[model samples]
Target: MLLTLIYLIASVTFIVGLKMLSNPATARNGNLIAAGGMTIAILGTIFLYEEDGQKLGNYGWIFGGIAVGTLIGFLAAKKVKMTAMPEMVSLFNGMGGACAMLISIVEFDHLFNKDSGVNFEWTAYPPLSALTSDSFFISALPMGQLLIILLGLIIGTVSFTGSMIAWGKLNGKVKDFSFKNQQVLNILMLVLIVAAASYLLWYCNQVGVKINVLTGMDNTNLPTESFFTNVKIIFYGLFVLSILYGVFFVLPIGGADMPVVISLLNSFTGVAAACGGFLYDNKVMLTGGILVGAAGTLLTILMCKAMNRSLANVLIGSFGGNKATGGGGAGKDQGTYKEISITDTAVVMAYANKVFIVPGYGLAVAQAQHVCHELEKLLESKGVEVKYAIHPVAGRMPGHMNVLLAEADVPYEKLLEMEHANEEFSTTDVVLVLGANDVVNPAAKTDPSSPIYGMPILDVELAKNVIVNKRSMKPGYAGIENDLFFQPKTSMLFGDAKKVLQDLVGEIKNL
Candidate 1:
């Protein structure tokens, strides 16, 4: 009972910590609080619980597993480069998925091995003595929870693989936005797996874990079958199907929708964890899973909203949509394309009184956030006022650019949201547009023909001088041309984001 009180306190801390995380100002503190709660929970599991009460067998294996996992997790967290953040996130999500699925597998195993305390015998089974016996599942407990658990396992497994695929695509492990015949394969596999799971469930109900045989009128028994045996077979089949489903589900999704897909996959992992909690009646698992699931879902929805898209549309994999056909007319015509050499452009920027740095998805792709932050400090040293203009939906996900900047130890107050910075853009002597494209394009507000017309954008064009960095005249993730590139106020600094920034840094110092 005392241990239960300790568990309750730990759970409360987890809840309160999560609540604190909702605000950006408090997020770091919230993470620490949550970590403290988890520590307490782990300690309670290891030391406070009665030996017989805890069902987990073999303490040696448990301790060994914990040690190994902790070592790996710590190493990965410490050593992983910021460029590999997407992959790191996917790996974490996969671990969560595996944990959830393993819990479900244990439950399933218990149900088949009726000797376990986790299993409850069906009252429908025959025997006069059994009829008189009392048990938990004898009447009202909804067995639908088992089905939900299985579904969660399948979905979670798929989500895990999908997220990994997304990470690969982002990192160029696989080519970006390449279409394959993977959609058809996913649909077919989903149907077949669902049918198999359904059949297994139905078989369990009909046989009730008993050895059953078909009998003729003369009572001659045919071949007998055990429900448990079939369940083992079905389980292996489910595992295979899960792997295939994961691969296919992610194969068709393109770069534009990858962030949304990642969020959706995270939600799946949470739902799977919640299902495990429901299966085991573990309150902590339920609470943690529900919180993560809700947060991930909300983030996914918000990303979709920011893109002016629906979740369904993203899943269908349009992937930033097609590039706009025909040239950007009136806007392009209004401005004379002034191409300046890197040396000349750098000199102008170096002498600027004030420079507002605008970062976007490309900056993230190049893993240049830290470098950009360093550049800002260097400029500040030279008496330039450096502020960051942040768009609401900058980078691959909401708060993505902010996270990168924050990771670089940039002061939160130094970042200005769109509305706050838009009014000041005109007065800014130099606007350093770092690897950003569509998010800062004014076409969203001014052109009715633009695909992104309904979306809001940063007002980078209002600046007197704009220095744009790019590798090509190629469109952004949206595949749409940016009018800002052609503007007289803007000069293109074409190269790898990191290299260009480095060169600019050198040039600023030289000046």
Candidate 2:
């Protein structure tokens, strides 16, 4: 009863924490509250949970592993730069997947060995005289337990391998790998996985029947020990195949859709964890896993919508491998782009009645969020209405730009999403794009041939004057040149984002 109370408290806290995360203001406190609840659940399980009158032992090893893991996690979170935050998230998520996978593996081993102290014997019933005059009836394999184990093994392994691939891609350590008929191969492998699992379950059912019938018969009809050995081999084969399928599942996807893939893999891990919870009959673990699974699935769907791509296309299509050329007024570089001096750009922003700031991955790379905020304040002091335009998938990960701006104490109201920002662009006098390219590019709407053609973008071109700050004329992460750069109304301000923003702030002050 005490353990149940602890679990209830943990479940309530998890729900409240998830609700609080809907707004940025309470997210930190919400995270802390959730962590505290999890601590309570773990402590309750370690100290209070028991099975067959036996409590947990090996305290030293358990606590020692916990201490080492906590220390490494703390150091990693503290030291990782904001620019590499996506990679860190992927790494941490992979760790969660690994934990769930290991849990499933250990449980399977316990069940298969039987000598590991867990009883899994089947009960026999008397046979009906109509069916067999002198035969014994036996229960089939515990299908519920077998199904849960299979689910945990499949989803957990996929999450672990897929998340590792995502981490590598985000960190620039891995690239998209594809071969002819890859999609077909993936489908075939998936079918084989299902077939193998079904065969294993059937084998288990047959073995159970044989063992039960032999219990009531003479030794002459008993099955050989090699039958059990073959069952173990089938189990091992299923595990190995599932692992290979996971690798193949994620290997063909390009880097551009990594954010969505990460969310999907996160959901997979959550479901896998829920399987573990089911196996152990733990309410707190089940609640936590369901919450994560539901939230991650929703986030993945939202990301897919933002990109204007279907989930199937994201998984199977090679969209970001090569840059698209031509179409949407991007036929060759007919003319060089216009350049603006820092003083002139500052003058335009200061004189404007309203200004819009569009941020992107480069802003994070240059670590200029604070200085950008300083420039906003300076412009506001001159009676310029300043606001920021944030794309949904901006900066490597979802909400990444918002996090950076929040750190600089940017007001929540000033950060506008793509749809709202697009509506305000036409009424605005100046749009200062800070190291942003693809999100603000006009090609998305105008060029059907472009890789990011159907994706929604900020309508920065509608503003009277546009100033773009960039280090060079290089294409964006999609490897496509932005046609917006060559427009007559757009003036390029070439420099590092931090340095450029610092200079612009000084110029605005002098004006």
Candidate 3:
């Protein structure tokens, strides 16, 4: 009862924390509350849990594993740069998937160990007792329990392998891999997985496990050992197939669609964990899994919407670095771009009625969020209204740019979403684009031939003056030239994002 109370508290905390996570101001506190609840739950389970009146043992192995994992996680997080956050998230999520997968495997082993020499006399699982001669069910394991185990194993393996692939892709360790009719092949794999699982379930229900029948002598009516061994083989085969399917699942997906893929994989992991909870009847684990699964699914939908694509389109279209019609723009001439001086930019922003700052992956790569915030503060001190224009898909992951800016202590109210920022661009005086590309491209609206044509973009071009900071005129992930750079109103400010923001801060202060 005490352990149940602890789980209840933990479950409530999960719900409250998830609700608080929706708002930026409360997100940090929300994380802490959830973590505290989890810690309490773990402690209660370790000390108060008694399964069948058998107290938990192996404290050394349990705490030692915890210590090692905690140390590794702490070190990895501390050393990870903001730019590599997407990959890090994938790696950690993969670990969760792995844990769920192992749980399913271990539980299945414990229940179905063939060498245990324990004869089943209709006493193991009450659910199996109802089976008559014609009932034709195999093993002392209940069908319901077996289903949960299979579900967890399949989903967990898929999430684990898929997330690892995603992590590799995000870190540039793996390249997109696809072939002719790749989508068709993926569909076939899905069908096979379903077929195999169905066959296993049917086979188990069709025959009962051998009872009191040994092959020494007079075993004519005994169930053949070979038949039972085949059942075990089928289960192992299903596990292997799941691993292959997972690898292929994420291989064809392009980098731009990684945000949605990551979210989807996260949902898979959650559902798998929930299966484990159901298997063990753990309330806290179940609640946490449900929350994570639901949240990830919703986030996946939002990510797809932000990209202006359907979930199916994202999975099969493989739209990104692969479909690049290069040269940074359409075949037409866009004219030459003019470069702007830092001093001139500083003067324009300082005297301007309003200025809009747009951040992108380059800003993250340069670790310029802090300096960028500094620049914003300096501009505000001069009575210039400064606002940040945030595109939904600005960084590698959803809410990534928000997190980066938040780390620098930027005000949440000053950061505007794409829709609101677009509405304000027409009234803004100077637009400073920091290391952003595809999100600000005018071709998304003007050129149908471009890969990102139908995608929504921030209308930074609508502002009176546009200053774009980039290391070079290199195309972004879209692989097409951005015509926004060639616009008469646009001026290129070539430099590293951090250096440019630092210089801008100094120049603005001097003015």
Candidate 4:
């Protein structure tokens, strides 16, 4: 009854937390609520062992693992710099995949040894009993269970390795879009695994008997060694196949589509988890898997919408890989840049009736959120209207901009979505673009040849005057030029985002 109630509370919190996340205003509170619920669930699960003789098998080891994991998590969070945030997320996510893979392997070993009729003599401890006779024992060689276990190992390993590759790319350890001669190696691995699987299957078909032994006596029905061999082969084959598939699948994608890839990988993780739940007949695993799968799918859809692309197009075009060549020529013709001093730009902004600010990955790299907040405060004190324009898929992941802004204590109401801000851009007197490109590029709306042509952007070009703070005229992650910089109404202020903003704030004070 207590477990049931605890689960119910956790489930309700998860649902409510998701609902709260729908609005930027409630996102922080929602996250906290969800965290509280998870804490309760973990406590309830740990307490279950106290009631019965049932334990986690190794209590000291379990506690040690927990302690180490917690310390690592805390240190990583505290020590990881903002510039390395994407890599950190990838690393953490990879660890989750690794953990899941280990769990699936442990379960397989338990089932395999039990089916093989393995026995051991006991000394001081109670004599070992036959696990085969245990009611919880899934069929010794249940094909479905075997398949799920195989899938879990394959997907989990692929996710772990692939995510590490992503982290390398983000950290510049690997060049963006570089493909290695790994296809042949992967293919060879696949063939070897398949051959092993075939051999195991043939052996399994030859043996039709089941065996389980306990106390020097046959205990119950179980599959022979051939069955376990076949299961092992399947797992190995699938693991290799998944690794090859993941590498090739992501190899063609460009950095612009990374958000989609992240979401898709997250979905794969959930599916793997669901398979694990089926393997163990564990309800909590099932629930968590379903929730994660559904949420990840939904997030992928939103990311596509943010990019104004279809799921099919994203997959085939390899938008997240190296295949994306920026929509180039159109922006060059329309965008004409004029350099301006921070003082001049600040003067124009100070006298403006309304200002809209667009932030991007550059802001994250510069760690400029705090400075930006100060600028906003300065502008407000002068009675200048200020609003922030945020794209759904801006930065490296979903809600990235929102998270950055929230960290700086930006008011929730000050942040505006693309749609809402679009309607107001034309009425605004100034649009201050900080390290933004693709999200505000006019080429998406006008150039049919653009890879991101149909993507939704913050209509920053609609503002009467535009001020872009950038280190260079370099294209964004999409590798495309932004036409907004060339517009007659646009002016460039070249520098680091934080330095430029600080200078602008100083100038604004003088005005």
Candidate 5:
């Protein structure tokens, strides 16, 4: 009863925390609440959990593992730079997938080897001898139990390998890999996985049961040694196949779509975790997994919409690679770009009544959020209104720009999403783009051949004046030169984001 109550508390906290995450104001507190509830649940399980009239032991091992994990996690997060946050998220998510995969493997071993001189008295492994014939499969284990185990193993393995690949790609350790007919191979692998798993189920159902087809009668017996041998081979084979499939599944996806892929992989891990929860009949674990799965799936769909790409496109389209070509606009002439001096930019922004600043990946790369915020403050002091426009899919990961700006103590109200910012752009006096490129590029709407075409972008060109800060005239991650750079109303301010923002702050303070 106490464990049940603890589970209920943890479940409630998870729900509330997830809800709080929707709003930036309560996101921090909500995270803390959810973490606190998880701590309570862990303590309750470690101290009071019992099954089959036996309690948990090995306190030294359990606490030691937890301590090491806590220390590693703490140091990783504390020492990691803001720019590499996406890689860190991918790495941590991979760890969750690994945990689920390990759980499924351990549980499968216990289920199959319980009576073969391998006593698992420390665990709450259901006694095969005690299980009745009611609703039972003809196999050694229940059909539902076996299904959960296999699913957890396959999904967990896929998520682990896929997340690792994503981490590698984000950190520049791995590049996008694709070949001819990659999608066809991906589909074939999926079909093979389904067929193999289905055959295993059929084998388990008929391992020792001899059916007289002409007589239309069957005799069911216990599974034979041959069945165990075959099952082991098929199960392990399935595991390896899933790992390879995950590698291929993410290998062809372009860098531009990685945010969506990460969200999708996150959902896979959640589903795998939920399967483990089902295997263990743990309510808190089940609730947490379900919440994560649902939220991740929903967020993926929203991100897809924000990018103006379908989920299918992100998964199989192989859209944008990381090969940057700094030249004219995707084979078309964009003419020459005009440069703006620091003094001219400061004067334009200082005298303007309203200015909108759009942030992108370069801002994060340069770690200029603080100085950017400082420039905003200095401009606001001179009677100019400053607001930040955040593209949904901007930066390396989802919510990357928001987190960056938040770290610099920017007001939540001052940061506007693309949709809301677009409505105000036409009326604004000036739009200051900070290290942004493709997002403010007019090609997305005008040039159909552009890789980022049809994707939602901040309409910075609608403003009366436009000033973009970039280190070079290079194309963005989508590998297309921005048409906005060469526009008559646009002026480029070339420098590192941090240095430019510092210069702008100094210029605006004097103005």
Candidate 6:
């Protein structure tokens, strides 16, 4: 009863924490509350959980493993740079999948070895087996348990391998490699996994009668030796096939779609974890898993909608793999982009009635969020209204810019979404784009043939003056040239994001 009460508290805390996370004002506190609840849950499990009236032993090994994992997780979180946070999240999520997979493996071994203190009777029903005078039958395995095991195996393996592939792509360790038949190969592998799992379950049910007869053999202590051998072979085959399916599942997806893929894989891991909870009859684990699974799924759907693409298209089409072929209005005949001096840019921003700052991946790479915030405060002090324009998919992941800006103590109210920022651009005097490319490119609006066409973008061109800070004119991750750079109203401010922001801040202060 005490264990049940503790689990209830943990589950409630998880719900409350999740609710709080939706708003930036309470997010940090929400994280802490959730962590505290998890701590309580762990303590309750270690001290009070029992299996068939037997307590778990080996405290030394258990505590040692926990210590090592905690230390490693702490150090990794501290050392990972903001730019690498996406890959870090993928790596950690993959570890969660691995844990669920291992749990299924251990439970399967325990059941097969008859070490779990539960009695099993495998009985075959009609239509599945025929009755014969000489034939022997045993009760069928528990269908619920078997289903949970299979689900945990399949979903966990897929999450693990898919997340690893995402990590590789984000870190540039793996290139986008796809063939004409890539989608076909992925579909084939998925079908094979389903077929293999079905066959294994069917074979297990059928082999029970043969094993029953073998159990009656004279002078044999364990008569089901062949049963274990055959089942082990089938299990291993299913495991291998599932892993292969996961690899192919994410291989054909392009870089731009990674945020959605990451969320989808996260949902897979959550569902797999829920299977573990069901297998163990743990209520807290079940609740937590359900929450994560539902939230990740919703987030994935939302991200797909934001991109104006279907989830099926994202999985099957290689949208970002090829270099952009359409030039939009970025033809050479367009006037050469003019570079603006820091002093001139600073004077314009200082005198402007309203200023908008747009951030992107380059800002993350240059670790300029803090300095950028400094610039916002400086401009606001001069009675100029400053606001931040954030795109839904600005960085490698969703909410990337929000997190970075929050870390720098930027006010939540000042951060504006794409639509809100666009509405204000026409009234704004100057728009400062900090290391952003594709999100502000006019080609998305003007060129129907452009690769990024149909995607929502910031209308920075609508502002009276636009200044873009970039180290070079290199194309963005989508490999598309930005037509906004060639616009008459746009002026390139060539420098590293951090250096330019610092120089701009200094120049503004001097004025």
lDDT (Cα, tens digit) per residue for candidate 6, span 1-511: 6888999999998999989988778978988889989999998889888888877788899999999999999999999977788999999999998888888888777766675433465433545346453434553465567768988998999999989999998988988878777777888888888888888777666534332333454221232667667777878788898888888888878877899999999988989989988998999989999899999999999998776667887787536443434554445465578999999999999999999999998898899999999999999999999999999988878889988998899998999999999999999999999888988987777788776777799999999999999989998766778878888899999999999999999999999
Q: Which pairs, if any, clash in model 5?
A: none
For every candidate structure, what is the RMSD over all alpha carbons to the true structure, in angstroms? 5.4, 3.8, 4.3, 6.9, 4.6, 4.6
CA lDDT of every candidate: 0.74, 0.83, 0.85, 0.74, 0.85, 0.84
Alpha-carbon runs more than 4 Å astray in model 3: 117-140, 209-223, 321-329, 332-335, 341-343, 381-383, 446-454, 503-511
**Which 10 consecutive positions of candidate 6 have the poorest summed lDDT?**
214-223
Model 5 residue 410 lDDT score: 96
State which candidate, 4 or 5, has the greater TM-score: 5
In model 5, which range of ten residues has the least summed lDDT? 117-126
lDDT of 5 at 163: 96
- Comparing 3 with 4 on lDDT, the higher-scoring candidate is 3
Better candidate number, 1 or 4, judged by TM-score: 1
lDDT of 2 by residue, 135-246 (tens): 4435444556777888888888878888888899888788878887888898998898899888877666664453223346532232347756776787778778777887
Give the per-residue Cα lDDT of candidate 5 at 287: 90
CA deviation > 4 Å runs, candidate 2? 114-120, 123-141, 210-224, 321-336, 506-511
TM-score of each: 0.84, 0.87, 0.87, 0.81, 0.88, 0.87
- Rank the models by TM-score, top first: 5, 2, 3, 6, 1, 4
Residue pairs in candidate 3 whose N, alpha carbon or C atoms collide under 3 angstroms: 328-480, 328-481, 329-481
**Candidate 4 weakest lDDT stretch, 10 residues:** 118-127
Query: Candidate 6: lDDT over CA atoms?
Result: 0.84
> What would you estimate as the lDDT of candidate 1?
0.74
Q: Predictions ranked by lDDT, top down?
A: 3, 5, 6, 2, 1, 4
Model 3, poorest ten-residue lDDT window? 212-221
Question: How many steric overlaps are in each model, in order?
Answer: 0, 0, 3, 7, 0, 7
**After best superposition, candidate 3 residue 417: deviation in angstroms?**
2.2
TM-score of 2: 0.87
